[model samples]
Target: MTITKKQITFSQAINDAIQTAMAIDKSVICYGLGVTDPNGIFGSTIGLEEKFGSQRVFDIPASENAVTGVAIGAALDGVRPVVVHQRSDFSLLTLDQMINNAAKWRYMFNGIHSVPITNRLIVGRGWGQGPTHSQNLQALFSHIPGLKVIMPSTTYDVKGLLLSSVFDDDPVIFLEHRWLYNQVGLVPEGDYRIPIGKAKIINKGEDITVVGMSYMTIEALNLIAVLSENKISCELIDLRSIKPIDSKCIIDSVKKTGNLLVLDTACKFGSVASEIITLVVEECFSYLKQSPRRITLPDFPVPTSPALTSNFYPQDLKIMEVISEMLSKKINHQKQERPPISMHDIPGDWFKGPF
Candidate 1:
């Protein structure tokens, strides 16, 4: 049961996934903006072109729609094309190919064709990237029927889930938060594939259930210390895949805890948070002690200034605030020990250089 492991950053895990997949399958290819650049899409695609050669790992232009179309076409021809987007905010331009073409091909064509493509869209923030660049738009793609939507929170999950997405027959939407690029964790040395639709229960408890999606999972982990101090036993679930979210796991956790809190990077309406709440309401309504609460950004444009952004993005403190309010405990605004992480534009100080 033992396995070898090595510590790696989230970005390096992503790079490792691509490298392994390309090495195993001749039909696998990686392309998109900055795939060949020095920064390498925040270093996830670092040195891919040099290692795999430009024919397999290369860059494309700003033609979102065109790039998607070509990738879809290539996928139809029995190639697995990994398309990278610098920012999920700008991926809106490629909806036609994503939603209509790639997402519906198998059903529309009577299962004659399969588009086994992986779309790696990097969600941006910090440095006042503003409304157009800082948005998390996984909800848009998760709504599509044929695509597999994933937002991995750890280095282990990133590599495994990316491997799963690469080998699967349908198109996959792989979301990576900019802040998570520097986060490090243990990753297996060999190939490992986590199931696409499964959710991981991070902590088991009885007081309440907290669901953290994408980067918010990291924040939730940080709030563990504060929650434990208050004797709030939290059952934390990481919703790794958004489309076919592990609803059964979420419902079971809610049933045990009798309270639910969802922390997501997107707005509440029609979001991953809303969808989880809907599942709980439909199947475990009677198990609730309190109404499910969702903590997410306002359904509006992200602020552009550093000062505005400090208050704009909710972090560990905000999660603690929401938890205390939900449990009817006195707000620990001043009493709580502040999180060790500095309040900054990005998560880490390692972001000084490119990527």
Candidate 2:
């Protein structure tokens, strides 16, 4: 396993992960909607079919449930299938297959059999994706037993986690935020793996514990500089894995900081954010200095208009405001920074959409 480093976008890292996995394993297969398209699902699947052949990397009809069922069957028969859904909302069509069968096959068989399937569900907010097209369902999937949910925010983690998911002997819900596809970072060359069920402390501070998932992690990171300047030290935790969440890391952080703030991409009600707050309250209630707080989208369908979408999606400024209130400090909006309201519908100016 030779290791070198180079800058790459989040989506390229994903493509590299799948390419590496398929290159090393004969049984690893990749298939899903728009997989073989020229655009290659935002270039994450480009050149895969040509490199590995259509037998292993092919397109499927838009029957998500049936396709997922077939993939689960293949996994049980010793094939590692990586199924990609263009939108996380599209995954709703396959819930019965995912929750009932794929997630329980190993347990139902007393651990003798396993479903080595990886479902890559794309999720995000942007460009009038609206309610139906842009839904963050990490919490919904994390509720199922025997299923591992992963949401990798950075380029490095995405590659490592995807590789791990593909090779794991159980079902893995690997979600990627569409906005993160263009995020560039230093990714190690060659194959490597980040263990499932682990959280990473991206920024360390003694004031507050901020746990974020997927794109929310990026938002949390952006606040570190402003928060620190205001004498508010923030300990930022990127929850790389949603289910089998890193309880020890979160508990330890809250014990030290005594304040908790969770930023989840999902809705406010019954979200992964709620689960994290509950865990902190249960494990470190006495250690907390203030009540745990979570910043999430309101419990309503996402609006399509740019004006509404701007307020719908929580960003760094919102996190800053929440942190200020939690710490009893006034927010200096003049010192805070954010993408212009004009670009609120997209992640950044660089975002040219295929949506």
Candidate 3:
């Protein structure tokens, strides 16, 4: 599938995608905070109310849990509902509705009920929003058993993933990075859908496999360019869908590259990164040449100051540094583990973590 190069901002691409879906499917309804009212905060859903009418695109009360529960109920009754949470941090309010109700309804109902609901969340860091507003909670949703978690970094993925999410029978948590909304990219002119539970290989390389999602995917792309300039070829995998992850792609990439680096914006501990790393090690341990390293935000709460936040959040430079160190260690290990290599010959730190 070839995508034409046409410039468009991320937010505009998302809006166009939703509008296109609504035009074709009357059951597709969008509702959330400031989405249908006087101020559509990001303008992603602006003018949608006019075209779709108030019934399809309307605003709800300032209750995240209630709004999500309403969407879940509608979805059960055959309505493809898209519930938007203005901020990712606010999704905490709907945990019960999401995890217990929406996620388990189908199993609890013996497959008679399906939750075809899409919960759109905006994740942002820095910009002086403080700890509360700047949290990246994709990992939290990804941990749930029945939810499909998607965090697209590019405008193309945003449109394709959202379109796919609308059609999926299971509940989907679509995370949009607030920082990438204005960033421009070329998207196909017509309706399209990128398959859910698929990973895209952004760059081909032989050295290390870097798995990233959401805005961190873009950061990984940038680091890949820099690493290439230094003669370090890195295979980049965009985990577009966090849940029902494309483990085959990751395993294959690690088998070829012999090293892995899982990068994420979520906290370092108990994050999606840990899950990815676990999968790679468990499935492709023999293929790995060195320990898998993860570049992620510190476990502490997000700081308010720009300088402090920058240090707390995982960035391109930090990723590059970690990758370089891993590569160096791999080279040294290969030299030591020659001919009759034993388990002890392999680096001890490589097996420290479970994954």
TM, every model: 0.95, 0.97, 0.90
* Top candidate when judged by TM-score against the true structure: 2
Please give, for residues 236-306, the per-residue lDDT of candidate 2 as tens digits. 99999998899999999999999999999988999999999999889989999988999999999998888
Q: Count the backbone clashes (under 3 Å) in each candidate.
A: 0, 0, 0
What TM-score does candidate 1 get on C-alpha atoms?
0.95
> Residue 54 deviation, candidate 3, in Å?
0.5
Sort the predicted structures by lDDT, highest score first.
2, 1, 3
Give the alpha-carbon lDDT of every model.
0.87, 0.92, 0.83
Candidate 3 runs further than 4 Å off: 1-5, 37-39, 329-355
Those runs of model 2 whose alpha carbons end farther than 4 Å from true positions after fitting are 333-341
lDDT of 3 by residue, 1-355 (tens): 7756578888888888889889989999999888975557476898999999999999888899988899999998999998898788899999999998999999998999999999999886555566787788877888888899999989988998999999899999999987778778988876899999999999999998999998888877766656766788899999999988999999999999999999888888889999999998899899999889998888888776655654666666668778879887322111212133233211122222110
Clashing pairs in 3: none
| Cα TM-score of candidate 3 | 0.90
Please provide, for model 1 over 134-176, each residue's C-alpha lDDT reduced to its tens digit, 9 standing for 90 to 100.
7898888888899889999988999999999999999999999
Give all candidate RMSDs, comma-separated: 1.9, 1.3, 10.0
